[model samples]
Target: MLLIDVVRVSEAVTRTSARLGKVGHLAELLARVAPAEAEIAISYLSGELPQRQVGVGWRTLQDLPQPKLVATATLTDVDALLTRIKAVSGPGSQAARKALVAELFSAVTSQEQSFLMRLLSGELRQGALDGVMIEAIAKASGAPSADVRRALTLRGWLPAVGAAALSGGVEALHAFKLEVGRAVAPMLAGSAPNVAAALEKAGVPAALEWKLDGVRVQAHRSGSEVHIFTRTLDDITPQVPELVEALLALPSTDLVLDGEVIALRPDGRPHTFQVTVSRATSKTDVPRLRAETPLSVFFFDALRVDGTDLLDLPYSERQEILTRTAPPELLTPRLTTDDVNKAEAFFTDVIKSGHEGVVVKSLTSPYAAGRRGAGWIKVKPRHTLDLVVLAVEWGHGRREGKLSNLHLGARDPESGDFVMLGKTFKGLTDELLAWQTERFLELADGPTDGWTVTVRPEQVVEVAFDGVQRSPRYPGGMALRFARVLRYRPDKRPEDADTIETVRALML
Candidate 1:
């Protein structure tokens, strides 16, 4: 199909307020695509490249050659260009890449150019992403949405599952199964305010396990070869040789283990989350860095073993299998109990061990991949503080022209000034967003950046965050981790806001 056709679908999806309307638009486009062009169309419409990274940036795109004002750029043509772009690297490859980018950009119409730019920059403002796209694929193929989601989850790639569903319908989706070496998107949990609430939501006989503050890893071992994947399914086998060796030495020849890899002190307590992230994201000198900052993995669940797929098994069955195969020292500390007292005690134990929190799971729940259902719940203690809102940035897409993203700052008691920890654009309802826009606009300074409206640091907003991290970007040398606005504090003054010292204390 023509690239313009897909662009029109994208535009229609972006323009609609209704989710079903967006899905319908995408479904219509998916139905007409050819089998071979299926992946490219889905990837493009989803604002991603099949080749993943194209190595082009905004600076390189700024001075691209003028468009030809033609709609002749096919999806296949774009894919080929991306392939060439990915191929260019090292030395004079920069100039070669620029030339290729300009050459490709010059071939498409101006509208197509705009679409390409948004897709390439990862700034496709459309609300439609993988979730919506999966629904659309299912709708187009006349398959159950649940089946499509399961297939996509098992395969960890939407385009391929989408193509199969298109070509072979529900049977193709049903044919998809858990493969030993393949990575699947792990099941995620919904959050509850406290342990009792989580247990209530997840029901009785809940399997509560330590929720470690670390990078989630899905390890696959078949014979001597082992592959380690992140929660997002990026293969990181080359980055952590020690992890590979550990998996390779496991008694089970074929296995898939779901767990968290945490950096720990020699005494066994976990290092800070920042240290864990640094160790996991390290790309240079795997063997050398592995010794400097070693990661200890604690397996919480098992999905496959010895060519047997265990995803369909209940949580208890999977846990039993994991305990049987996983090394005792590497197993995540867990408790299976219906008593709220026991669950609460386990939660307290996890906190005392320097972990994040506890995950309460249903005993009878199957591994529902890529879905955040009521089967699992994460219970975390909220740490809240009154912080001053320094500024509010304009929202995007549906939220356009509204004050949404908040610039939160903590009071520096020593200097009597607010220091920016970070910004949060989450946990706001439409009503709250509109109210903030109106209220913050009244307190706006005379001059504004058009995108950001600066205001006096008098409005105190109650913010709840997971924790604080050492950051070089902020003047306070710290930033709030996963910060969200709970509500505006009308009674509190900026002087009563939490201090930088308080934020730093949380880090400790």
Candidate 2:
């Protein structure tokens, strides 16, 4: 296929908000692609390449000697260039794609060319698809996104995994764990509307912990080789050699453990999220990191211990096994207080000692892998609610051309009205602002002008608020103390969003 041909698909993918349009675009492009080009296209489109992918992701980005020079290079020329680069440099080099993109951009007219650049750079985000990347892929493939999702969920790769069946066959993708693992973001909770009551009904004690303002880490081990990964599953092994050494020293352990790796002071007080980020930095700075912002981990759950599936075990049982099996430096502490008063004492103690509130846990609940269930309840006097974005306002300074702040709202349980809870300028990123402005517009219905747009409550957002305050902003004189966009909810709906009544109840 011509480079321009690929550009057209990317153009279509960007402009059309409908899932089917994006799907049709990719399908059309794939039908005409040569074997190698198909491989490149499919691989890149998956967003996550193989664990250690076949080529430098930037290969196409950096290969061009004069990528920004803007000179036309034939698709045949681009193909030949990529083939030559691939043959000479193998998978680690990024030059090929750079040159191909440069050539493609040059070949197309100016307008299409700009879209192509954004497409290649991953700045081409359109919030129109129902939800997530796979849904859009499903629309493109003429199948349910759910079906495509299942195939990838079950098989671990997508479009590319499916596309590869044409040549190397599905067996080739057998070991594929599609989404690149090890980049630790965070594992969020999916809770019942009434978390406390839900746990009571489920025949489990609801233990609540102050949801930490820290990063999550997943440690994977193969014999003595221990690798630490982020929630996103990106390996930070090279950065935390001490952690790896600590895991390797563990006795009777061939495991992958789940925990929060946090930075703390010499006096044992936990630091803020900003400090915890140092644990994810490079090994070259380890000496300085240790000296400046020392750290420790709190192991809450174990996934694979000595090759046993620990996910089925009860929470208390997992903690017991973790304590017995883990090394001192490798483990996160488990707070045990069955009595509410004792738990309260511990919670107060930790908070006063500069720690966040304590997490109360259910002894009998099984490890809900990649889930937040009634087994855990975080009891803090501090007010917090996971809200959904109702609207966004224009930004200024460095944040210009993007959303300045979000019109944060919580669900009204009685009428499903997304009553405006507050507006937040906190946690605004240039990229996020751009992403949300375009996204917030998608949810708009009537004119909610004068710096706000009324949205059809569809997206759920997690907002960590300082406290709820009385405000004349909306019916409830309650507004958020501190508010920010945590993450975009794919599994949750506005109906499932936290409500003002729930927020007020927490005031108790």
Candidate 3:
């Protein structure tokens, strides 16, 4: 398949507003993809690359040669070029990589160049996320959508699932199952206002677990070998030896446990998120970092035990399995109750202990990986909303030349456009400032104003505020008061952002 075909389909998907329309366009494109190009095509249409990283940055993309008048490159050609570029390293490798990038970019037409730029920069906003892509794959391959989604959840790789569905249909998708070594997608939780609301959404006879401020870790143990993965499924087995060793010491030799790794103070309060993430992701001087900020593992759910898959089991059964397999010190502090007052007390105790809040989970719901259903509800004290970054203003003083003040927006479900609510510059560390500057520059839409740089609304950020107030300064007719950034939600897309109606309902 030609690269231009994929670009055109992406454009079509972007122009589409109806979900079925988007799925139809993607399905049509998938039907025409060749078997060899299935993976590349599917990944591109889904706003990702099979190569993952090609060692190219915004600076490298700034000085590209003029695009060709016509498109002639095949999908396979570009994939091979990226593979070669990713392999270039050491002495003069930068120049070699740049030359290859230039060669590849110079061969494409204008539209293809734009698509390639977004695809490389991770800012493709065509709404063809995993959900839409799964529906398309099922439609094209005649496989059930549930089967496709299950395969994606277990495999944690959408392109491979797409290829398998296309080549072998239902039989191939059924082959994907919970394995001891592979990392599956972690189950997510929805948000509620308080304990009562959470219990209402999660139903009675629920298990409330302390929601700690820590990095999510999924540990898979097979005999003596243990592998640890983050929420995004990035393997960091070597960086977190303590976690790996802890999982290996468990009684069950073969099990997949979902948990969190946190750094605690002497009084048992959790350290800042930056401290935990820095220690967990550091690649240099690991021994020293570990000694400085030791991490403690806490298991909450068991996905597999003794080579038996427990993903299909209810939360009640999984909790029993986890309790039996992991020692008490390794389990997250939890409480099971049907009384709302008791649940509220548990939430209050968790908060007083310097934890985030409590996650109320249904006892009978099976593990639904990669889906944020009502099976589990998270209740936090403050008013928090998941908003998208619409634009960013240049910082001044010590933070000069960085993207500092963020213009936050809420999704308008009816029109599918983001409505700007307010701007915030608080709660951003120097590291976050540097990271967002580079990231926002890659998503830059056009020439920036003297102070603000407008970008595509694709980055979802969690914002905590005291309350919402009616205001005329924004399009949403309200603004977040004392708004501050909590963290970036890379696991969520813009489509998952809270709607404007939800924001309006929070008015003081």
Residue-level lDDT of model 1, residues 1-508, one tens digit each, is 8888999988988787677888899999999999999988988887778998889988888887778766888888888988999999899998999999998899898998999998887756465767688789999999998899999889888888999999999999999988877999888876677889888888998899999878889999989888898876778888777678778778999989999888999988899766786788789887778889998888898999888989889999999998889788889888989999988989998898888789999998999887667899887667766799998899999999899999999876433457999999888989889999899987786465588888877798877888888999988888888998777755345655767776786773
The top-ranked prediction according to TM-score is 3
Model 1, TM vs. native: 0.76
Arranged by TM-score, best first:
3, 1, 2
As for lDDT, the candidate ahead, 1 or 3, is 3
Between prediction 2 and prediction 3, the one with superior lDDT is 3
The full ranking of all candidates by lDDT, starting with the best, is 3, 1, 2
- lDDT tens digits, residue span 394-508, model 3: 9999988898999999987554578999999999999899999999997888876568999988899999999999999998889999999999876457877887987887798
- Alpha-carbon deviation at 458 in model 3, angstroms: 6.4
RMSD in angstroms between candidate 1 and the native structure over all alpha carbons = 11.6
Q: lDDT per residue, candidate 2, 33-87, as tens digits?
A: 6655554555434332222232323335443332343335334554454345345
Q: Which regions in candidate 3 have their CA more than 4 angstroms from the true location?
A: 58-70, 90-92, 394-404, 410-419, 426-449, 455-460, 468-481, 487-508
Residue 411 CA error for candidate 1 (Å)?
Answer: 28
Residue pairs with clashing backbones, model 1: none
Name the runs in model 2 displaced over 4 angstroms: 1-102, 106-115, 128-131, 135-186, 190-203, 206-212, 309-321, 327-330, 335-346, 358-381, 384-508
